[model samples]
Structures are given as C-alpha cells and as structure tokens.
Target: MTQTLTVRRSAFTVALTLPVLATALLALPPGTAAAAAPASGSAIEWGPCAGMSGLDPRQQCGTVPVPLDHADPSGPRIDLAVSRIASGKPAARRGTLLIIPGGPGNAGLHEPSRRGRQLPQSVRDAYDVVSFDPRGTGRSAPVSCGLAHEDLAMERLRPWPAADGSIDANTATARRLADACQAGDTAVLRTMSTRNEARDIDRLRQALGERKLSAWGVSYGTYAGAVYAQMFPHRTDRWVLDSNDDPDPARVARGWLANYAVGVEDSFPDFADFAADPGNPDRLAARPGDVRPLFLALAARLDREPIPWPGANPAQLNGNVLRQTLLDSLYTKQRFPALARLIAAARDGGPLPAPNTPPDEAMQNTVAASLATICNDVDAWSGEGQAVYEKDVADSRARHPLTAGMPVNVMPCAFWDLGPSEPATRITPHGPSNVLMIQNERDVATPLAGARELRDALGDRARMVVVDSVGHAAYVDNGNACGDAKVTRFLLTGERPARDVYCAA
Candidate 1:
C-alpha cells in the first residue's frame, strides 16, 4: 500500500467543565501528588531494545506502568516504553535530562540514542539522558483508529479543501475520521492528552528516582514541556523549548493549526532563494521573486489536470498534493531540493518520485494518537459549526493562498465525540525562571510568531534565543553556532542570556 505523506513535526479544542477544572487544580501540586505515582516496587527492568536498528548500544529499554485512566489509579494499566543512555561520565553526572519528542504522536523511545547522542559531550556527561513513548504511542499499548488508506494521505490529514475552495469534502472527512475513532478502541485514546503526557513524565521521573528533570523539548514537545513546567513548577530544572506553539488555553491545538498559514509565509522566502539560485540544478525560476508565482501557477494547473502517480497515496499528483509536499519540504532547507525537483518534474511531465509512506500499521497508530491528543485536549472545537468552518477556511485561503485554507479547515476534532477529560493546562510565568526558548526566525512547522506567544505566556519565567535561520527545531538542528552555543552553555552551566538574544544566520 502507498504510505500517507505524514506531517511528522506539524500537527485541539474545548472549554473546561467544573469537574475538569478541579482535576486541573488537583494536578498543580508538585511531586508525586501532581501525577499518578507508579506502584511501589514496580521499576522498569532495563534491557536491550528489540527491533530498533542503529540505536546506540549503550541505550537500554524498559517499561513503566501508568494508569490507563489517571483519574482511576487502581484501574487498568498500560506500559510506557522508556529508554535511557546513562551519562558517559557518571561520576560527573548532575541529574537526568529528559529528551522529549515532538508530534504529540512521535515516539521518544529512540531519542535517547538518536538526539541524545547529538548533544555536546559536556552536556551529555552532566546527565543521564532519558526518553519515553508517551501513552498510546509506540510500545506503550498503542491504539489505532484503522483509518482507510486514502484517508491517511497528507492532503486529507491536513484537511485541504477541494480545488474550488469548497470544504464539503474536508468536512465529510472530518466526520468520517471522528466516527472511525469513536468506533475503535477508545480506552487508550481517551488517555492521550498533553496533560497526561506531563503526568506520565513525572511518573517516569519518580521511577528514575530523580527529584527534578532538565529537558530539551522541540516542536510539539515544546508545548508539552511548557505544560510540564506549569503543572510541576518545582520539579523542572533547566528547560529548553525549541520551535514553540501558541499556548492560548482556549484555543490550544486550534491555534497551533491555524498558525501554519503564518509559518509557511515566514519560511517560504528561504526556499525561494534556494530554488531560484542560478547555480541550483532544480532552479524553479530566473529570479527568487518568480519562484512563488511559478509554484502557484503550477499548482493551479495541476488542480485542473492531475498527473497519474502509480503506487502513491491517492494515486496522483494534484494541486493539494503538491501543496502538501511544499508544506512538508519547507520544514527544513535540507529538503528544499526535493521540493524543487518535484515541482520541476510535475511541470515538465517527468516521472513522479516514489512516495515516502510509513507502514499502514504505523500510520494508523500515529494518526489515532495525534487525533486523540488534539481532539481530547479541549472542547473548544466542538462548538464551531460547519458554517463557521467554511467562513474560516475561506478567510484563511484569502489571506494565505499557499496553505489553501487547510490550516484552518475542519478536522476530526470538530466532530470528536469525547470531550476533554480535564481542562487544558494554561502555561504561565508562574513557574521557575529556568526556561530557555530557541526558535528559528523562519520555521514553517512552528513559526516565530507562535514561539513569541509561548515566550510571552511564560513572561519573566523564560528567555528566548531567536536564530536567524529557516526551518523547524533550533539548537543543533537548523540553528547557528551562536544559538547552539547559547543552548549548550545553558545546559552545561545553567547560563542564559540576561534577556532575549538574536543570532544572525
């Protein structure tokens, strides 16, 4: 089966009921009381990880049992897959540094070996790096909605409207996905929320016997890290949030999705520069300014006449598919050439590139978890009717033609049956002044605008480092030496710029 073109880094709802508000309040206390503490004498048995290739040999895997429903501690339990690579210089170890993965759906089981090893040696030596697959993901008793193959495509997942700008198909898709998830096993889906993920982190901290956790959270992980900081203020040491999202408590996931319009506009110029350079083989235009128009025209042309692409999801390269490809490619400059090539091929009637899709089973798991987290995070989405969505989509398309209203279009959350179990945790400046945010000036997935929102929300509790680079996830990935140096110093010596600092490309 052709795999869906998933948006790995990129990717809520609802108001708080009285009971939900109380649940949020009860979780404010620091330490074990704030989280569902694991049962006594139930520690993860560290051993070799199965089936993960290229993992660092030093990384060991384990599982910690967290309540399937945190509200009922003695109820059914699910095993959270955890991984760790002990400090290279254990004698100099200060504490644990949790490597939080993004996507809300992305697994962190391999992060201890992948991103963990990428850290500076001094930073690595200072802490035992650890990560985990949040509940309902990876080996943590995974859940799937069993969505059909076509529904898993990027254009559908991102809710791109029809070529005519009508959102009828998109709305239908939203309702269908919502129904599928509702009919599937919802036990684990109900438990998948950012708040619960924070609670899960605390549980892991307890299992590891750490009093506090210093963490590096990127992309969606940044939002997760902020929530953790808010819910357990005293338990976080040095915090690093990269490529942040807007943390409007009322909007939550909704705001993050809508921000893509701004993010793409911010990041596209860099790709235009690369794609229009005279020296580039895949140059799209004679001038950087022309690249945008060329792309737009090509997309419009494809909308009217899609080229058949055998063995690919949806089996053709249409305007929305091209648009989705552009969105995915803009995540990093390293991917710019691929986008350029695809655009050039589609325009010239060349053979289509092979589709990159994950196994059906993996796609199902990721989509299910992602939908559950965003939909179950809050009830804010349920109130927006189809007419409201149509107006929003039209407005979004008018303002941002590149994204074609997909960012603000209807999603499964709009039709989700299960409302939030608890209120979305509002991140505030009330936490310890220990956060350091690093953001790319032009990140498509998590734009600077949203990062600033998060930075502002944290108030005096955080300082931000703005890197004059394009792409997602600053600090060692798509970041300058100045920004990397700043983050590394903070991790190693607990030093931050006295205030927000900017780094030139």
Candidate 2:
C-alpha cells in the first residue's frame, strides 16, 4: 500500500501520571524539603512561542544553557528549548512535572500544553507542567546528516532487509547513513546520548530552580528517565515511567532494536484478528486463521514484482515497503484501516494510498538524533561486517518472519564514529520507591518482556500496572479506562496499587 511518504519519524503519543516520593521523605519538615531546590539562577524569561501550533497562548517558552558535555561543567554550552504552563492554582501546586517525550529524538516542547490538556484538573492544578526538545531536536540546536530523500524515508530508515532475509541493502545503507552523519556536525551529534539527555534534564531542573522534579516519561523517554533515576536518585521527586524499556546497560540500544522481533510477534495477532473480522469495513480475510498466510503471500508476491508508485521517494511498492507499512500500522488500532486498504489496493491492483509528506528537514533531524543516541549510548554493534549480519538475519527470519529479520539486521551504530562517553547507566533497586510503571499487555516498540526487565531491576522501588490491552501505550490513546483510571489516581493522590496488578481492558 503506497501512502504519501512523510519523513519517517519513530515516535508514539502517550499521556502520563506520577507517583509520590519515598515514605520517609514525607516525614521531612513541612517548611523545607531536602531535594526541593537547585542552585538559584536567573528566573525563566518567558515569551510567546513562535511557529509552534496547538499550544495554549498562555504557554510560555524559554531556553536553558547546559554544558555540551556534562563532564566539563564549565565547558561550551548549548540551549535547550523548554515550554511550561504554570499551575492554575499556585497555592495548591505540588511542584514541577516534566513531561518527557517518546522518541530519543522527538520534541516535547508542545507537550506541556498538548498532553496537559488531557490531564485531570486536579493534577494540572497541582503542578507546573513542562517539557522540552532534547539536545538535538525541534526548537533546540538541531542536527542533521543531510541524508538523501530516499534514505530519509521510513522504510529505508528502519533497515528492513530485502525479501529473502538478505541484508546486503541494509549494510550498504547503514554505512552510507553513518558516513553522512559522521561528516555532518560531529560535536553535537556526539553529545546526543541518553546519558547526556538525562543530564540535560537535570540542567533544566536546576535552571528551573527546582532541586528535584517529578517526571512522566514515555517510550524512549522511559529509558532516559530510568537513567536519570539511577544517576541522580535524590534529584527525583515523583516518576512515572510508561511503556518501559529493558534497562540492560550492556545491550542498551541494540536490545531495543532487536526487540522489534518479539514485539511484532506479540502484537500481530491483534491486527490479524482485526483484519479478519467480517464486520470490519476493511476486512482482509474471511477468517482470522487466513489473515497471516494471506499477508505473507501478498508480501512475497510484491517482493517478486513491485508496483510503480510515483511521488514516493523510492518510487515503487516493493515488498519491504509493504512490510514497513504493516509494522507502522500495527502501532495503534486507528491505523489498521490504512494497512487493510493498502493490502486491498495491492491485491486488487488499485492506486496506492497517498503518503503523508512531512518537510525534509524534519525527517533529517529526527533520523540523525535517533542514530546518535542509539549509537553513542552503548557499543552493542558487533562491527563484524555483512557476513555475520547475513547469518543473523537468516536465522531470525526463519524464527520470526513477520519482522523479516530487520530487528537483528545491521544499523549505522555498527559503524558509529564515536563510542559512549561513559557506559550506559545500569538501572537498579537502589533508588527511592518513587516509580510507578504502567504498560500495555502488548506493545510494538517496547514489549512487555522488556518492561518486566525494568520492573525486576527496580525491585521494591516500583510497582507496575499491566493493562489488558493491545498496541503501544496504556494511557490516553489506548481506550482502556481501567488502566487510565489507575494511573490517574496514582498521579493525583500519590496512591499506588499495593502490589503489581492487572487492569482488564
């Protein structure tokens, strides 16, 4: 199914609520909180935001200066674009709540106003909602590799292997992208690791005059939040990590990339069931049992003979493109029609769906930042060249064909220009018991298994609320009131479920 080709950005929208601090801290003197204030500095000089849409007029924008490399606190600094909507009831305000976005590259400057709108009025009145564009994204100092239009497309950017599980194209593409990024702005690119992002958040906190800040982090933001909690436990007030990631420091980004294999397998059945429902206007099969084989056959046929698709960067409806579309459409139920229609069009030899075309610059910035963080956060890439990747791809394809071995395929990280400045921070149980994790039963990006890894790592410091729902997020977008209510209650009242619990859909 050909759709308007938008610059492929890898991010999902999610809402969040937070937990209260350690019980011991609750006993502190009412007048003073130990980690409640940072070194005093000039107050934020708020001004009208320009070019950003869907934000309240009252939403104010500003910037904070942070060391480009936290190692040198006095070294060169960079500006981080931040936005905030002050508490409507200052007397009732609990403190500041930082909203962290999903993608390692996604901009969250509008989140304070966007997601804030969905939050309960009590939660809103209790905190100053805030978010920002991470180091190399959005209104902050952005970076780009100036990748070719084709390279920037979602299908190509995801490293999907050619149909027979061959990774020849993936390897060459990885090298091309890695070289371009290395040749671009090396300094800024090198500073774009999860660790640096966490540090940047700390800097933002200090600049905001909050010694400790509460946070609601989603997707990749969950990882960044975990690192922050691990590195600066005392600096955290309340933390809500939604759709968690595995905190395996050794496999940092590599594990996340590879997790697509399990994630797709875990979530595809939901899509299949949807596609085969006779009542579905866009149903693709007569029965749920027939959906999988039908999709596999159609994908194979496209692999053998692609249809010409004008206006798209690659200009053809190839097998990998269809596969990429399938992966994307599974993210949420609303996108199911796009996939079903694409399949119907492809099967019936009709015109492909129009793709959503985002500006080229937006694509460049997102792709560059994603690569920088994944590559700089850890040394997971084997650097063993094409032959090894080929073997891994073949093996993965045999086991999980739905993913076409792309999850295990080579990426630019194998050829990254720089290594992690420091090892990825290991998440542990040493932090205060201030974290509450909420996850959907099936998530395409961050799977439940990975969420479990994080939960295990946090041990007694956290409680997880598992939602009996499909798709990525457990909050706003996913229609699970049971899950939403639990999360909302916890954030609003500092009340967590006594133990791990499940919320039925």
Candidate 3:
C-alpha cells in the first residue's frame, strides 16, 4: 500500500496545574438548527454537551450565527460551533480569552477546554477561555467536496510531485480537487476564507457580550487572529500569536506553503543530530552529516523501486510518500521515532508498518475546507501549465532536496475556480500594541524567518520571543521553560518582554 500523509498538526498545550471548573450546562438554545443564525445581541442558552468524552464537564458547547456573506447581512447565515470554559473565580475574572486552533480546517470548538487545562491558575482565573469551529468545519455546518476516499488522502491533498520533479500528476490532482470543491457546494465552500472566519469571530464576541477579546492563536490561527486584529482593532485586547505566519497580503497561503522548503532545511539539522545520536534507540546514521544524504538516497531508491504494501493508500511505498512522512514527523520531537522506525525498517527491507488513516469523511471535510480557505484567502497562484510548475519544482528540488520540490509544487489553489472576495487583509502596526509573538527558532511549519517578517510588519505593536528550540510552535508545546514562562506571564499579566528576547533551549 502506498503510504498516505495522515499526520495532522497538534494543538499546543502546557502541563500546568490549574483548578478545574465545576460541571456546567452547555450554552445555546434548543432546536437551534446547525445552520441557524443568531441575532447580534442574542444570548446562547446554556444546556449538557454530547459526544466529547474526556472533555471538561464544565466545558459548554454552543453555536454562534454569522452572515454567510458578510456583505449580505440579511441573507443566508451559517452556524459556528463554539465552546467555553468560564473563569472559575469571577471575582478575579478579567475578560474573555479566545483560544484559536491551528489549520484553516482545524476545529477550535474543544481547544479552549484542552488548552485551558495547561494555563496557569492566575491566567485561567483571569478570563473565560473560548474557542469555535470556523464556518465550514466540524459542527459548524461541516462541508465536504464529496470527494473520493483516495482523493481525500493527505498525500494526495498535499501535492507531492513525481520523483523526476515533474508536476504533471500534481497539476492533474490540483485541477481535480479544485473542480470537485467548486462543483460540490458553492455557498459554504466559497464562504470559507480567512476574512469570513475573522468576521465570524467578531460576531462571536458580540454574542458573548464582550467588548474586547484577548486571544492566543497558534499556527494558521495566528494569521486569522492577525486579520481579526487588523479588521477590528478596537475589539482586541491582549493578543498573543504563537508560531506566527507571514502576513504578506500578496502571498498568504502560497508564502506559507513555500516556506516549508526553508523551514525543513532550517530544522533538518536538529533531526540529523537526533538521528545520529548513538544513545538513540532508533538512530538512522552513525554520523550527523550522513543522515541527510541517507534520507535523500532512500527516497530516490524508493522512487525507482516502490515497495508494495497492502492496506495503505496507492498500495506502495514511493519516494514522495516517505518524504511526506518525514515532513509530517518533523513537526515535533515526539514524532521523531516514527520516522526513524520507518527509515530503519526500510533499510533492512522489513515489512512496512500500518499507515494511520483518519476517517474519510473527516479528511474530506478538512481538505475541502483547507483548499477553500487558501484559494479564497488571496489572489496567489494562477492556473499555469504543468511545464511552468515542473521547472519551478525541479529548481526547488535541486536547491532543497529535503522537501523534494514539494514546497513550490502546484496545488489546488493554482487551479481554484474561485478567487478571494476581497484582497487579503494587510496586517499592520495600526492595531493595539498588546500583541505578543512567541516562535521557535526552528519551526518546520512557520519558520523563524516568517515570524520575523510578521514582527517587522507589526512594527511597534508587537514584540517577539524567539525560543532556541527546534520544531513547530513555541508556547507550551515544543518550547522550553523560558519561552513558556514569558508567554504565560504575558497572558496572565499583559507584561510582554521590554524588547524582543531570546529563550535558550
């Protein structure tokens, strides 16, 4: 079976000891249709959440309605699945703290409860932690392209080109996915841009009766949070964007996708060190310098002679699949062993491991929502021909073989049938100066360079903490004590670093 990319980035969390709030009723009125719209001043009738086991019993689930198209206020409306864990001590309560999840498609509905567990007592006591599923995600009117199970595979969705650096198959996949999304549901799909999500957030704040919202947004959520700050500056309180993204309006998602090249290169040395450590049980190489070459050679060999594996996507282990696995595993240190095991097994011609397969319907929704957002967030790529993409991919492959030219490869956005409803929102220093950024020095998703770009764009409005750690995100997960301390302090007391500072790993 061909291994498919099934690794999804995780939400960052800390291991702080905080008081758990008492069990409370779920919010939002009964008979609320999944797509029901709420009035601006309408209060969510608090009620028991169903289906989420191990979640805090006090975590309440509700829905907020926002205009499907913000322009047509009185037109069609869509529901946003929301959850909240109110501050335990109202006497010390400050205000609302929104916990934005990563991924354009990742559901934030349970993030508040999950992440809230890691917050310091003071921080948890200071504000209500809340999160929501964006317009076309999860319980918020979930949408799918009705795509085939194979089409929904992460390997297929991520556009890993042919081994020869040819984008012919990639281009075809892009067109197929794009066409499927466009032909499926125009209303929800076309409305799944970042701008709309940000607007939906504001509507949520209003429904909660909060004048301003403080937020901790991670990964792609950082971009959404920045957009929210830019669009509704007065509505923002203390904002912390961890593992930031480049807010270059000209290249939104495209820039992020491209940064994977630099990101992987920047973080590969860390992986090399691990792979070469003699103490490591699954070390892939005897010397640190040999790891990269070994990985590249292994991938090339697989490209030439794909190993047959039953039960996995495509039923074979090809080079790009291995590359995808490597890229996904690089997201965190804990995931290193998975990649090492694969490399060690492959080196011995051992049996391939069983692949992780997420529910097809879930991936269908995720990929569809992700594509819709990226394609509609900005005017990034054009419907260029395969030759153009092939040349670009070939050049990138030569320049950065670690990524196998996948970073610059064509994706559904290139052949997207829809365009942004408006130009991408430009993030500026014009917002509140309460923004604080925490980033890892070696992030495989959003690199340090991109975080610097965002810091530069935010100007005096933001200050960044560069953690000397390796991996994605900085606060809580994949970050050191110094970094986590600084972020927690800022979240609790609004005391940001006097100037940009570095936290040694």
Candidate 4:
C-alpha cells in the first residue's frame, strides 16, 4: 500500500498503516455526554481470510451491523466487515485495540490477519486487536461513480493537468467524474467522510461491548483517529498515531494532495541512491549525481512523445505517468528497481511495461471512497482563482520534473458542486494524554512536516518520536530497530518519553 500521491498513486502508499505496534489501553473520559453504545456480544467468532487461516483459532471475522445514520439507528442499516485477533493471553488482557488504517480509501479489515504475526507478544497478549473497513469500503456497502475505463486510470482520476500545463482536460475530467458519481448510486458516496467514520467507530465500540478502545492509527487513519478521540474522548484509550498527516481543518484532503511535492523531494534521493548501487541488477547510474538528469531527460522525452503501451490501463508513458511513477517509487527502498526499469525502458525507445491496475471492483470502491472522504471533509474548490494553481503546476513541473503538473493542478474538488456532508470534527486537546506519535524524517505522502502540525495540535496529550529515516511510515518502512523498539515498549506498558525523542538516522 502506498501514500496515494495520488492521482490514486500506487506503490507509494506506505505512510503509516504499518503491520503492528504497541500502546496501552486508556480509561474513558468523564463529565461529558458520551452516549452509551449498543449492546454487543462478548466473544469473537472465527472465519477464514487470505492470511493465516483457521489454524489460528483465536482469529475471528464477522460483519458488525451498523446504521447508515447513527442519529436514526432504525433507518437503513449497513454492515461493516470486521476481523479480530483475540488476546493470546486472556488472563493478562486488558481491552480491545482498534487498528485504524490510512487512506481515505484504504481499509484495514484484513489487518488483524495480515499483521497478527508482527505484534510484540506482550501487546498481543494484552488486547484483542481489531480492524475494520469503514463504510463504502471493503465488505461494507460501497459506492461506485460508474467512471469509464479511461476515467478510472490513475492520471485521469487524480486530475493531472495536460502536459502543456493546461487545465482544460483537468476541468473536463472533474466534470465527468462528478457527473458519473452523481448520476450513479451516490447515496452512500455522498455520506462518506472522516466525521462519519468517527461516528461509525463509536457504533463499533458499542457493538463490541468495549468500554474504551485503544487504537493504532496510521497516515490518513491518524487524522480519523484524532477526530474520533476528540468527538468521543470518553471512549478512547492509549492511542498510537504513526506516520501522521496534517489536520489542516480547512484543507484536509487538499493539504494531503499538496504534500506530494515535498514528499517527492524528500524521497527521490533514496531512489537515486538505490539506482546507483553497485550491485543492483537494474542500476540506472553508477553514481548518484547521474540519476536525476537521467530521470528528468527521460520524463521530458516521454512528455513530448509517449511510449506506446497498448493493453495497459492508460496505455502510454506520458508526462503524468512518469510523474505518477516517480511518486509511487518513493514509498519504499525495494521499489528502486521499478523506477530504474521504467526509466531504462522508456529511454531505450521501447514500449514501457504495463503498470499495475487494481481490479475494476477494487478501483471503483477505492476511488469512490477517496472522493467521498475528500469531498465531505472540506470544500476543496480553492476558489482562490485557478491562476495560483495553474502557475504552481507549471512551477512544480519545472521544479519536481518527476511529478510533472499533477501535484499542483486542479482536481475534481475544484469543480465539485456539492458542499461537505458535515464539517470536519475538530481534534481537541481536551482528551486523554495517551497519544504516541511515531514518524519518519522523510515521508512522501504524509511528510514529517505535517506530522509536526498534528503533534502540535495535540499539545500535551501526545508524545513525539521522530525517527531519522527517509521513507513514509516509520514503524515498518524505516527498518530502524531503535524506532521500532521505542514504539513496542510504549505499547506494552504505559511508559512514555518524558519529552520528545528523536532517533538518529
């Protein structure tokens, strides 16, 4: 999973939402009108998943039925698919921990199974780890915009401007996508956002019979978890916000989109280093200095004349494709080979290999959810005049040649006709002082800079652990034993740094 730099970026999606980590359970808040949740059964029921199957008798999965509207519980109800890995040490178990995944589009329903092996045993023994797909996502009732095949392509969906820096195409795409979503089954799509997700979490809490929930929220999920804690402080417990994002109350998703430029700058060097490594089978350069020029020249060539790639989703190596590729490759160290291969193939005057395309069903659900959350979070139509964005897009193309004009261009939100379903919930500092933030020094999607904003917003309620790393999401992507140890230690016990801790690179 990558940081969707978006245009629904692939490969570069790994900002937070890592495998597992620790954080102690917390007690709920007092002197507040926190509503009591619904009645829930006491046990987890087992089932099979793509990960470790029935062999792990402790793991169970089921659909936790919830109302489409919590205000009207008797109204139309939808089911949220869920998975739980019950406490291995029942005697030592304290409570439940919710695994909040990043990506407004990303779902964590499979996490308990996918990451059951990664959790430290003490953390595992103490809590029944649970994760779920938010509404309009996996196993839950999903929304589809009925976009055309070409419209589903990453570049088009993300509103990457024309190579000439013209937004005429972007405007058209916005209209088309907006019309498609509005004309299709949009009831669910219209209602999706971080605010609703917070409501949904509360319902899940009631359904699970847990008095309080300890959470491990990553990337986009960190924002969601923060909003949840603010709205229902009494229900939250020891929370871990790893690889955090900006809580720019006004431009939540837009801020997320703009972070791509810094993200690329922060990460491209890693790609360059990997491309220059001596033994790399697909080394693009023998020295780090040569990698940037090589990528830039290749991208410019592709922009003027795209490489033919029939059968691929977008079917060409145009400027945005190159830009999109650059964003995707920055998420992980292992992806250096991919950037090198793409550059080599394009430079050799040959057809670039087909890029990965998720199944139509998966892509549709992802796009729909991504759009819904962004649109519903805040009005993205920056009405500050397209001049700034257009000029910025051009400047971005010149500055960050790898991303072309995608990061700074107009998006569907710019031309959207709808207002938010609800205002973004404010992340108040008046909650439990149980938040532990772990972030990498350089993150492409949710950069460390944004994490600091989140840390500041939380004030005294959270502790910071900045790992001297260059990738997005630290716990898993950083591969730093020191950073990993700090998080695992805090989660197993209620221990925390007396002040902000920074791990050496």
What TM-score, over all chains together, does every model reach?
Answer: 0.92, 0.91, 0.90, 0.88
Deviation of model 4 at 123, angstroms: 1.8
Sorted by lDDT (best first), the order is 1, 2, 3, 4
Give the winner by TM-score.
1
Ranking by TM-score: 1, 2, 3, 4
How well is each residue in 1-505 modelled by candidate 1, as lDDT tens digits?
2112111111133334323222222222111212212223326699999999999999999999888877778998988999999887857787888988899788889998889868888888888888999888899989889899998887789999898888888777888898899896788887789988988898898888877788999898999999988877777788899889889889899889999999999989999999889999888898889989999999999999999988778889999999999999989888898889889999898887887766778889899989999988877776655677778888999999999999988788877767577788877767567889999999898888889999999887788999999988888886489999999988877777888999998
Candidate 2: regions farther than 4 A off:
1-42
lDDT of 1 at 470: 90
Looking at candidate 2, what is the lDDT of residue 301? 97
What shift in Å separates residue 391 of candidate 4 from its native position after superposition? 2.8
Instruction: Give the Å shift of residue 505 in candidate 2.
Output: 0.8
lDDT of 2 by residue, 1-505 (tens): 2112112222332221212222123222211223344225426777888888878877999999889877678999889999999888967776788999888889899998888888778888888899999999997789899999989888888888877666667777887898899886688888898877887988888878887888899899899998888767778877789898888988987898889889888888898899999799999988888988998888899999998887776788888888888887777878888899989999999989886556788899999888888888876674465667777888988998888888888888777756565666777777577788999888888999999999999887788989987787676657778778777776666666778889887
Better of 1 and 2 by TM-score: 1
lDDT of 4 by residue, 402-471 (tens): 6676777777766454446445655556656777899988788988888888999888778889988776
Residue 106, candidate 1: alpha-carbon lDDT:
88
Q: Write the per-residue lDDT of candidate 3 for residues 371-467, one digit (tens) a residue.
A: 8899888756764455667778888888999887888877877766566666787776664567889998999999999999999988877889999
- For model 4 the TM-score comes to 0.88
Q: Pick the candidate with the highest lDDT.
A: 1
